[model samples]
Target: MAKVHAEAQKEQILNAAARLFIEKGFGGASMQEIAEALGMTRTAVYYYFKNKDEILTALVEEVTLRARRLSSRATSEANTDPKEWLRTLVHQHTMLILSHHNEFRVVDRTEQQLPERAYRANEEAKRAVLSNFTAAIEAGVKVGVFRVVDAKVTAFTMIGMCSWPAFWYKPDGPKSAEEIADTIAELAVQSVIRPARRQLKSAGDVSEALALLREDLDHLSLMIEKQPKSG
Candidate 1:
Protein backbone atom coordinates (compact mmCIF):
# COMPACT_ATOMS: atom_id res chain seq x y z
CA MET A 1 0.00 0.00 0.00
CA ALA A 2 2.83 2.37 0.74
CA LYS A 3 4.51 1.64 -2.57
CA VAL A 4 1.24 2.08 -4.42
CA HIS A 5 0.54 5.39 -2.72
CA ALA A 6 4.02 6.57 -3.49
CA GLU A 7 3.62 5.61 -7.13
CA ALA A 8 0.37 7.52 -7.39
CA GLN A 9 1.92 10.53 -5.70
CA LYS A 10 4.87 10.39 -8.04
CA GLU A 11 2.61 10.48 -11.10
CA GLN A 12 0.62 13.32 -9.58
CA ILE A 13 3.75 15.35 -9.00
CA LEU A 14 5.14 14.66 -12.46
CA ASN A 15 1.89 15.60 -14.15
CA ALA A 16 1.67 18.72 -12.06
CA ALA A 17 5.26 19.59 -12.77
CA ALA A 18 4.81 19.11 -16.52
CA ARG A 19 1.89 21.52 -16.62
CA LEU A 20 3.65 24.15 -14.51
CA PHE A 21 6.88 23.88 -16.44
CA ILE A 22 5.10 24.20 -19.77
CA GLU A 23 3.22 27.26 -18.57
CA LYS A 24 6.01 28.97 -16.64
CA GLY A 25 9.24 27.70 -18.13
CA PHE A 26 11.67 25.56 -16.14
CA GLY A 27 13.43 28.22 -14.07
CA GLY A 28 10.26 30.19 -13.51
CA ALA A 29 8.42 27.25 -11.97
CA SER A 30 9.24 26.54 -8.36
CA MET A 31 8.97 23.64 -5.93
CA GLN A 32 6.42 25.68 -4.03
CA GLU A 33 4.18 25.89 -7.05
CA ILE A 34 4.54 22.20 -7.72
CA ALA A 35 3.77 21.23 -4.16
CA GLU A 36 0.75 23.55 -4.08
CA ALA A 37 -0.44 22.12 -7.37
CA LEU A 38 -0.43 18.67 -5.81
CA GLY A 39 -2.24 20.00 -2.73
CA MET A 40 0.76 19.15 -0.61
CA THR A 41 3.41 21.17 1.16
CA ARG A 42 6.83 21.87 -0.34
CA THR A 43 8.35 19.24 1.94
CA ALA A 44 6.11 16.57 0.49
CA VAL A 45 7.29 17.38 -3.01
CA TYR A 46 10.88 17.44 -1.77
CA TYR A 47 10.45 14.01 -0.25
CA TYR A 48 10.04 12.53 -3.72
CA PHE A 49 12.40 14.96 -5.49
CA LYS A 50 14.90 17.21 -3.79
CA ASN A 51 14.73 20.09 -6.25
CA LYS A 52 13.44 21.36 -9.56
CA ASP A 53 16.50 19.85 -11.21
CA GLU A 54 15.40 16.42 -10.07
CA ILE A 55 12.07 16.89 -11.84
CA LEU A 56 13.89 17.95 -14.99
CA THR A 57 16.14 14.95 -14.70
CA ALA A 58 13.15 12.67 -14.23
CA LEU A 59 11.51 14.03 -17.36
CA VAL A 60 14.54 13.29 -19.55
CA GLU A 61 15.02 9.86 -18.06
CA GLU A 62 11.38 8.96 -18.74
CA VAL A 63 11.34 9.71 -22.47
CA THR A 64 14.81 8.43 -23.20
CA LEU A 65 13.78 5.16 -21.61
CA ARG A 66 10.74 4.99 -23.91
CA ALA A 67 12.87 5.68 -26.97
CA ARG A 68 15.33 3.05 -25.82
CA ARG A 69 12.49 0.59 -25.32
CA LEU A 70 11.23 1.20 -28.85
CA SER A 71 14.65 0.40 -30.24
CA SER A 72 14.99 -2.68 -28.09
CA ARG A 73 11.72 -4.22 -29.24
CA ALA A 74 12.34 -3.49 -32.93
CA THR A 75 15.93 -4.75 -32.87
CA SER A 76 15.13 -7.97 -31.05
CA GLU A 77 12.82 -9.10 -33.81
CA ALA A 78 14.47 -11.43 -36.31
CA ASN A 79 15.03 -9.54 -39.52
CA THR A 80 18.05 -9.06 -41.78
CA ASP A 81 16.86 -6.47 -44.31
CA PRO A 82 18.35 -3.03 -43.69
CA LYS A 83 15.64 -1.02 -45.43
CA GLU A 84 12.77 -2.65 -43.61
CA TRP A 85 14.56 -2.31 -40.31
CA LEU A 86 15.21 1.38 -40.90
CA ARG A 87 11.57 1.94 -41.72
CA THR A 88 10.74 0.21 -38.46
CA LEU A 89 13.23 2.50 -36.73
CA VAL A 90 11.60 5.54 -38.25
CA HIS A 91 8.18 4.38 -37.19
CA GLN A 92 9.36 3.45 -33.69
CA HIS A 93 11.07 6.81 -33.21
CA THR A 94 7.97 8.63 -34.35
CA MET A 95 5.74 6.54 -32.13
CA LEU A 96 7.84 7.29 -29.08
CA ILE A 97 7.49 11.04 -29.62
CA LEU A 98 3.77 10.81 -30.22
CA SER A 99 2.82 8.40 -27.48
CA HIS A 100 4.51 10.45 -24.80
CA HIS A 101 3.66 13.88 -26.17
CA ASN A 102 3.71 15.71 -22.82
CA GLU A 103 6.92 14.12 -21.68
CA PHE A 104 8.25 14.71 -25.18
CA ARG A 105 7.55 18.42 -24.80
CA VAL A 106 9.32 18.54 -21.45
CA VAL A 107 12.29 16.62 -22.81
CA ASP A 108 12.56 18.60 -26.04
CA ARG A 109 12.44 21.95 -24.27
CA THR A 110 13.89 21.40 -20.81
CA GLU A 111 16.92 19.19 -21.47
CA GLN A 112 19.34 22.07 -21.11
CA GLN A 113 17.72 22.76 -17.75
CA LEU A 114 19.21 19.61 -16.24
CA PRO A 115 22.48 19.61 -14.30
CA GLU A 116 25.72 18.49 -15.93
CA ARG A 117 25.40 14.80 -15.14
CA ALA A 118 21.75 14.68 -16.13
CA TYR A 119 22.47 16.72 -19.26
CA ARG A 120 25.27 14.33 -20.20
CA ALA A 121 22.98 11.38 -19.66
CA ASN A 122 20.38 12.95 -21.93
CA GLU A 123 23.02 13.63 -24.58
CA GLU A 124 24.25 10.08 -24.23
CA ALA A 125 20.77 8.76 -25.11
CA LYS A 126 20.61 11.14 -28.06
CA ARG A 127 24.02 9.99 -29.19
CA ALA A 128 22.91 6.40 -29.02
CA VAL A 129 19.93 7.18 -31.24
CA LEU A 130 22.13 9.04 -33.72
CA SER A 131 24.73 6.33 -33.63
CA ASN A 132 22.00 3.94 -34.70
CA PHE A 133 21.19 6.29 -37.56
CA THR A 134 24.86 6.49 -38.59
CA ALA A 135 25.17 2.75 -38.57
CA ALA A 136 22.08 2.46 -40.78
CA ILE A 137 23.57 4.94 -43.25
CA GLU A 138 26.90 3.16 -43.28
CA ALA A 139 25.26 -0.21 -43.82
CA GLY A 140 23.24 1.14 -46.69
CA VAL A 141 26.30 2.78 -48.22
CA LYS A 142 28.24 -0.47 -48.09
CA VAL A 143 25.36 -2.23 -49.81
CA GLY A 144 25.55 0.40 -52.60
CA VAL A 145 22.04 1.46 -51.61
CA PHE A 146 22.45 4.58 -49.48
CA ARG A 147 24.97 7.05 -50.89
CA VAL A 148 28.07 8.16 -49.01
CA VAL A 149 27.39 11.42 -47.27
CA ASP A 150 28.48 12.74 -43.87
CA ALA A 151 26.69 9.98 -42.02
CA LYS A 152 26.96 11.67 -38.63
CA VAL A 153 25.40 14.98 -39.63
CA THR A 154 22.92 13.38 -41.93
CA ALA A 155 21.85 11.02 -39.18
CA PHE A 156 21.33 13.93 -36.79
CA THR A 157 19.31 15.83 -39.40
CA MET A 158 17.18 12.78 -40.10
CA ILE A 159 16.30 12.52 -36.41
CA GLY A 160 15.45 16.23 -36.24
CA MET A 161 13.12 15.82 -39.17
CA CYS A 162 11.27 13.02 -37.45
CA SER A 163 11.39 14.54 -33.97
CA TRP A 164 10.33 18.15 -34.73
CA PRO A 165 6.69 17.24 -35.08
CA ALA A 166 6.41 16.38 -31.39
CA PHE A 167 6.92 20.07 -30.61
CA TRP A 168 3.98 21.47 -32.60
CA TYR A 169 1.98 18.45 -33.63
CA LYS A 170 -1.76 18.59 -32.93
CA PRO A 171 -3.89 15.49 -32.95
CA ASP A 172 -7.14 17.04 -34.22
CA GLY A 173 -5.63 19.56 -36.58
CA PRO A 174 -3.85 19.70 -39.94
CA LYS A 175 -2.24 16.25 -39.95
CA SER A 176 -2.28 13.08 -37.89
CA ALA A 177 0.93 11.95 -36.20
CA GLU A 178 1.12 8.83 -38.35
CA GLU A 179 0.66 10.87 -41.52
CA ILE A 180 3.46 13.22 -40.55
CA ALA A 181 5.60 10.27 -39.59
CA ASP A 182 5.10 8.60 -42.97
CA THR A 183 5.86 11.84 -44.75
CA ILE A 184 8.97 12.36 -42.64
CA ALA A 185 10.06 8.82 -43.34
CA GLU A 186 9.62 9.39 -47.05
CA LEU A 187 11.51 12.68 -46.99
CA ALA A 188 14.30 11.15 -44.90
CA VAL A 189 14.68 8.37 -47.44
CA GLN A 190 14.99 10.86 -50.28
CA SER A 191 17.34 13.14 -48.36
CA VAL A 192 19.67 10.47 -46.98
CA ILE A 193 19.59 8.12 -49.94
CA ARG A 194 19.36 9.76 -53.34
CA PRO A 195 17.32 7.89 -55.90
CA ALA A 196 19.38 9.09 -58.84
CA ARG A 197 22.45 7.15 -57.74
CA ARG A 198 20.70 3.82 -57.23
CA GLN A 199 20.86 2.86 -60.93
CA LEU A 200 17.28 1.78 -60.46
CA LYS A 201 14.78 3.23 -62.92
CA SER A 202 11.40 3.17 -61.16
CA ALA A 203 9.64 4.12 -57.92
CA GLY A 204 9.14 0.41 -57.34
CA ASP A 205 12.88 0.05 -57.19
CA VAL A 206 13.12 2.67 -54.44
CA SER A 207 10.44 0.94 -52.42
CA GLU A 208 12.10 -2.42 -52.86
CA ALA A 209 15.47 -0.99 -51.93
CA LEU A 210 14.24 0.56 -48.69
CA ALA A 211 12.47 -2.64 -47.80
CA LEU A 212 15.87 -4.31 -47.72
CA LEU A 213 17.36 -1.53 -45.57
CA ARG A 214 15.14 -2.36 -42.61
CA GLU A 215 17.41 -5.10 -41.28
CA ASP A 216 20.30 -2.75 -40.66
CA LEU A 217 18.00 -0.37 -38.78
CA ASP A 218 16.71 -3.16 -36.60
CA HIS A 219 20.26 -4.16 -35.76
CA LEU A 220 21.06 -0.55 -34.85
CA SER A 221 18.12 -0.38 -32.47
CA LEU A 222 19.21 -3.59 -30.79
CA MET A 223 22.68 -2.20 -30.17
CA ILE A 224 21.26 0.94 -28.55
CA GLU A 225 18.94 -1.04 -26.27
CA LYS A 226 21.92 -3.00 -24.96
CA GLN A 227 23.57 0.16 -23.63
CA PRO A 228 23.83 0.97 -19.88
CA LYS A 229 20.16 1.34 -19.00
CA SER A 230 19.10 4.93 -18.38
CA GLY A 231 16.01 6.22 -16.54
Candidate 2:
Protein backbone atom coordinates (compact mmCIF):
# COMPACT_ATOMS: atom_id res chain seq x y z
CA MET A 1 0.00 0.00 0.00
CA ALA A 2 2.83 2.38 0.80
CA LYS A 3 4.47 1.55 -2.52
CA VAL A 4 1.23 2.25 -4.42
CA HIS A 5 0.74 5.49 -2.51
CA ALA A 6 4.27 6.58 -3.31
CA GLU A 7 3.73 5.88 -7.00
CA ALA A 8 0.48 7.86 -6.92
CA GLN A 9 2.19 10.82 -5.32
CA LYS A 10 4.90 10.76 -7.96
CA GLU A 11 2.22 10.78 -10.67
CA GLN A 12 0.49 13.69 -9.00
CA ILE A 13 3.72 15.65 -8.94
CA LEU A 14 4.35 14.92 -12.60
CA ASN A 15 0.82 16.00 -13.53
CA ALA A 16 1.19 19.27 -11.63
CA ALA A 17 4.55 19.93 -13.24
CA ALA A 18 3.17 19.19 -16.70
CA ARG A 19 0.32 21.65 -16.18
CA LEU A 20 2.71 24.35 -14.98
CA PHE A 21 5.07 23.68 -17.86
CA ILE A 22 2.25 23.90 -20.37
CA GLU A 23 1.10 27.18 -18.88
CA LYS A 24 4.51 28.81 -18.51
CA GLY A 25 6.89 26.68 -20.63
CA PHE A 26 9.65 24.54 -19.17
CA GLY A 27 12.11 27.45 -19.03
CA GLY A 28 9.56 29.80 -17.50
CA ALA A 29 8.16 27.42 -14.88
CA SER A 30 10.08 26.99 -11.64
CA MET A 31 10.08 24.18 -9.11
CA GLN A 32 8.54 26.46 -6.48
CA GLU A 33 5.71 27.29 -8.88
CA ILE A 34 5.08 23.60 -9.46
CA ALA A 35 5.07 22.92 -5.74
CA GLU A 36 2.68 25.79 -5.15
CA ALA A 37 0.36 24.44 -7.83
CA LEU A 38 0.24 21.15 -5.99
CA GLY A 39 -0.22 22.93 -2.64
CA MET A 40 2.95 21.22 -1.45
CA THR A 41 6.23 22.57 -0.12
CA ARG A 42 9.16 23.01 -2.48
CA THR A 43 11.03 20.37 -0.53
CA ALA A 44 8.15 17.96 -0.96
CA VAL A 45 8.18 18.47 -4.72
CA TYR A 46 11.93 17.89 -4.67
CA TYR A 47 11.36 14.57 -2.94
CA TYR A 48 9.92 13.21 -6.20
CA PHE A 49 11.88 15.31 -8.70
CA LYS A 50 15.15 17.03 -7.92
CA ASN A 51 14.45 20.01 -10.22
CA LYS A 52 12.34 21.31 -13.10
CA ASP A 53 14.58 19.60 -15.66
CA GLU A 54 14.04 16.21 -14.07
CA ILE A 55 10.28 16.63 -14.27
CA LEU A 56 10.50 17.65 -17.90
CA THR A 57 12.80 14.74 -18.67
CA ALA A 58 10.43 12.30 -16.98
CA LEU A 59 7.42 13.59 -18.92
CA VAL A 60 9.20 13.59 -22.29
CA GLU A 61 10.71 10.15 -21.71
CA GLU A 62 7.38 8.66 -20.68
CA VAL A 63 5.59 9.91 -23.80
CA THR A 64 8.48 9.01 -26.13
CA LEU A 65 8.70 5.49 -24.72
CA ARG A 66 4.97 5.00 -25.10
CA ALA A 67 5.14 6.13 -28.73
CA ARG A 68 8.10 3.86 -29.43
CA ARG A 69 6.29 0.85 -27.97
CA LEU A 70 3.20 1.59 -30.00
CA SER A 71 5.16 1.94 -33.24
CA SER A 72 7.16 -1.22 -32.53
CA ARG A 73 3.95 -3.16 -32.04
CA ALA A 74 2.50 -1.79 -35.25
CA THR A 75 5.67 -2.69 -37.15
CA SER A 76 5.61 -6.25 -35.85
CA GLU A 77 2.08 -6.80 -37.13
CA ALA A 78 3.32 -7.49 -40.67
CA ASN A 79 0.08 -8.94 -42.01
CA THR A 80 -2.18 -6.07 -41.05
CA ASP A 81 -4.07 -4.34 -43.86
CA PRO A 82 -2.21 -1.24 -45.01
CA LYS A 83 -5.20 1.10 -44.86
CA GLU A 84 -6.26 -0.27 -41.51
CA TRP A 85 -2.69 -0.04 -40.24
CA LEU A 86 -2.47 3.63 -41.14
CA ARG A 87 -5.84 4.33 -39.54
CA THR A 88 -4.86 2.55 -36.35
CA LEU A 89 -1.53 4.38 -36.22
CA VAL A 90 -3.12 7.82 -36.53
CA HIS A 91 -5.91 6.95 -34.07
CA GLN A 92 -3.48 5.61 -31.46
CA HIS A 93 -1.10 8.58 -31.81
CA THR A 94 -3.92 11.10 -31.53
CA MET A 95 -5.30 9.29 -28.51
CA LEU A 96 -1.89 9.37 -26.86
CA ILE A 97 -1.56 13.11 -27.50
CA LEU A 98 -5.07 13.72 -26.18
CA SER A 99 -4.48 11.72 -23.01
CA HIS A 100 -1.15 13.48 -22.33
CA HIS A 101 -1.81 16.85 -23.92
CA ASN A 102 0.19 18.79 -21.33
CA GLU A 103 3.12 16.37 -21.49
CA PHE A 104 3.03 16.41 -25.28
CA ARG A 105 2.88 20.19 -25.39
CA VAL A 106 5.91 20.40 -23.13
CA VAL A 107 7.78 17.87 -25.23
CA ASP A 108 6.88 19.62 -28.45
CA ARG A 109 7.67 23.13 -27.22
CA THR A 110 10.60 22.45 -24.89
CA GLU A 111 12.64 19.66 -26.47
CA GLN A 112 15.66 21.97 -26.45
CA GLN A 113 15.46 22.11 -22.66
CA LEU A 114 16.02 18.35 -22.27
CA PRO A 115 19.46 17.15 -21.16
CA GLU A 116 21.80 16.00 -23.96
CA ARG A 117 21.43 12.29 -23.24
CA ALA A 118 17.65 12.59 -22.76
CA TYR A 119 17.31 14.53 -26.03
CA ARG A 120 19.23 11.89 -27.95
CA ALA A 121 17.15 9.11 -26.42
CA ASN A 122 13.94 10.92 -27.33
CA GLU A 123 15.17 11.48 -30.87
CA GLU A 124 15.96 7.79 -31.26
CA ALA A 125 12.45 6.86 -30.15
CA LYS A 126 10.98 9.40 -32.56
CA ARG A 127 13.00 7.93 -35.42
CA ALA A 128 11.64 4.49 -34.66
CA VAL A 129 8.11 5.85 -34.75
CA LEU A 130 8.82 7.50 -38.09
CA SER A 131 10.26 4.24 -39.40
CA ASN A 132 7.01 2.46 -38.67
CA PHE A 133 5.02 5.13 -40.46
CA THR A 134 7.32 4.93 -43.46
CA ALA A 135 7.05 1.15 -43.56
CA ALA A 136 3.27 1.27 -43.42
CA ILE A 137 3.17 3.76 -46.27
CA GLU A 138 5.61 1.67 -48.32
CA ALA A 139 3.41 -1.37 -47.83
CA GLY A 140 0.42 0.53 -49.09
CA VAL A 141 2.31 1.74 -52.13
CA LYS A 142 3.62 -1.74 -52.93
CA VAL A 143 0.05 -3.04 -52.83
CA GLY A 144 -0.99 -0.24 -55.22
CA VAL A 145 -3.33 1.27 -52.63
CA PHE A 146 -1.43 4.51 -51.92
CA ARG A 147 -0.05 6.82 -54.61
CA VAL A 148 2.62 8.64 -52.65
CA VAL A 149 5.56 10.22 -54.51
CA ASP A 150 7.85 9.54 -51.54
CA ALA A 151 6.94 7.31 -48.64
CA LYS A 152 9.26 8.99 -46.14
CA VAL A 153 8.04 12.47 -47.01
CA THR A 154 4.42 11.36 -46.93
CA ALA A 155 4.98 9.67 -43.58
CA PHE A 156 6.43 12.85 -42.13
CA THR A 157 3.56 14.89 -43.54
CA MET A 158 0.98 12.56 -42.02
CA ILE A 159 2.78 12.61 -38.66
CA GLY A 160 2.86 16.40 -38.70
CA MET A 161 -0.87 16.49 -39.40
CA CYS A 162 -1.61 14.10 -36.54
CA SER A 163 0.74 15.76 -34.04
CA TRP A 164 -0.48 19.30 -34.66
CA PRO A 165 -3.54 18.64 -32.52
CA ALA A 166 -1.43 18.35 -29.38
CA PHE A 167 -0.72 22.05 -29.55
CA TRP A 168 -4.37 23.07 -29.93
CA TYR A 169 -6.64 20.35 -28.58
CA LYS A 170 -8.94 21.37 -25.72
CA PRO A 171 -10.74 18.86 -23.53
CA ASP A 172 -13.85 21.05 -23.48
CA GLY A 173 -13.88 21.48 -27.26
CA PRO A 174 -16.79 20.48 -29.46
CA LYS A 175 -15.24 17.41 -31.06
CA SER A 176 -14.04 14.38 -29.13
CA ALA A 177 -10.51 13.11 -29.68
CA GLU A 178 -11.86 9.99 -31.37
CA GLU A 179 -13.80 12.10 -33.85
CA ILE A 180 -10.76 14.23 -34.64
CA ALA A 181 -8.66 11.12 -34.98
CA ASP A 182 -11.11 9.63 -37.45
CA THR A 183 -11.09 12.76 -39.56
CA ILE A 184 -7.28 12.94 -39.56
CA ALA A 185 -6.96 9.27 -40.42
CA GLU A 186 -9.35 9.63 -43.31
CA LEU A 187 -7.54 12.68 -44.62
CA ALA A 188 -4.17 10.95 -44.34
CA VAL A 189 -5.35 7.96 -46.32
CA GLN A 190 -7.05 10.08 -48.93
CA SER A 191 -3.95 12.24 -49.35
CA VAL A 192 -2.02 9.21 -50.62
CA ILE A 193 -4.69 7.45 -52.62
CA ARG A 194 -4.74 7.49 -56.41
CA PRO A 195 -7.55 9.39 -58.05
CA ALA A 196 -10.06 7.36 -60.04
CA ARG A 197 -9.49 7.45 -63.79
CA ARG A 198 -12.03 9.05 -66.15
CA GLN A 199 -13.53 6.93 -68.93
CA LEU A 200 -11.58 7.11 -72.22
CA LYS A 201 -13.15 9.17 -74.98
CA SER A 202 -12.22 8.81 -78.69
CA ALA A 203 -11.57 11.78 -81.03
CA GLY A 204 -15.24 12.01 -82.19
CA ASP A 205 -16.44 11.85 -78.58
CA VAL A 206 -13.98 14.60 -77.58
CA SER A 207 -15.12 16.86 -80.44
CA GLU A 208 -18.77 16.35 -79.44
CA ALA A 209 -17.95 17.23 -75.81
CA LEU A 210 -16.13 20.40 -76.88
CA ALA A 211 -19.06 21.41 -79.11
CA LEU A 212 -21.53 20.93 -76.25
CA LEU A 213 -19.28 23.01 -73.93
CA ARG A 214 -19.11 25.84 -76.55
CA GLU A 215 -22.93 25.84 -76.89
CA ASP A 216 -23.34 26.18 -73.11
CA LEU A 217 -20.75 29.00 -72.95
CA ASP A 218 -22.45 30.89 -75.85
CA HIS A 219 -25.88 30.62 -74.18
CA LEU A 220 -24.44 31.96 -70.90
CA SER A 221 -22.80 34.89 -72.74
CA LEU A 222 -26.09 35.76 -74.49
CA MET A 223 -27.94 35.65 -71.15
CA ILE A 224 -25.31 38.01 -69.64
CA GLU A 225 -25.51 40.42 -72.61
CA LYS A 226 -29.34 40.62 -72.26
CA GLN A 227 -29.10 41.74 -68.55
CA PRO A 228 -29.47 45.51 -67.95
CA LYS A 229 -26.05 47.29 -67.75
CA SER A 230 -25.17 48.84 -64.37
CA GLY A 231 -24.52 52.61 -64.43
User: Model 1's lDDT to the true fold?
Assistant: 0.76
Q: Which segments of model 1 are wrong by more than 4 Å?
A: 1-9, 35-47, 72-78, 193-231
How would you encode candidate 1's per-residue C-alpha lDDT over 71-101 as one tens digit per residue? 6566556275556656777777986676566
lDDT, candidate 2, 105-164, per-residue tens: 778778887888878888999999899999989988776677755988888998888888
Full-model lDDT, candidate 2: 0.82
Give one clash count per candidate, in the order shown: 14, 0
| TM-score for candidate 2 | 0.78
Q: Give candidate 2 regions above 4 Å deviation.
A: 1-4, 195-231
- Model 1 lDDT at residue 186: 76
In candidate 2, list every pair of residues with a backbone clash.
none
- The total of clashing pairs for model 2 equals 0
- Local error of candidate 1 at residue 189 (angstroms): 2.7
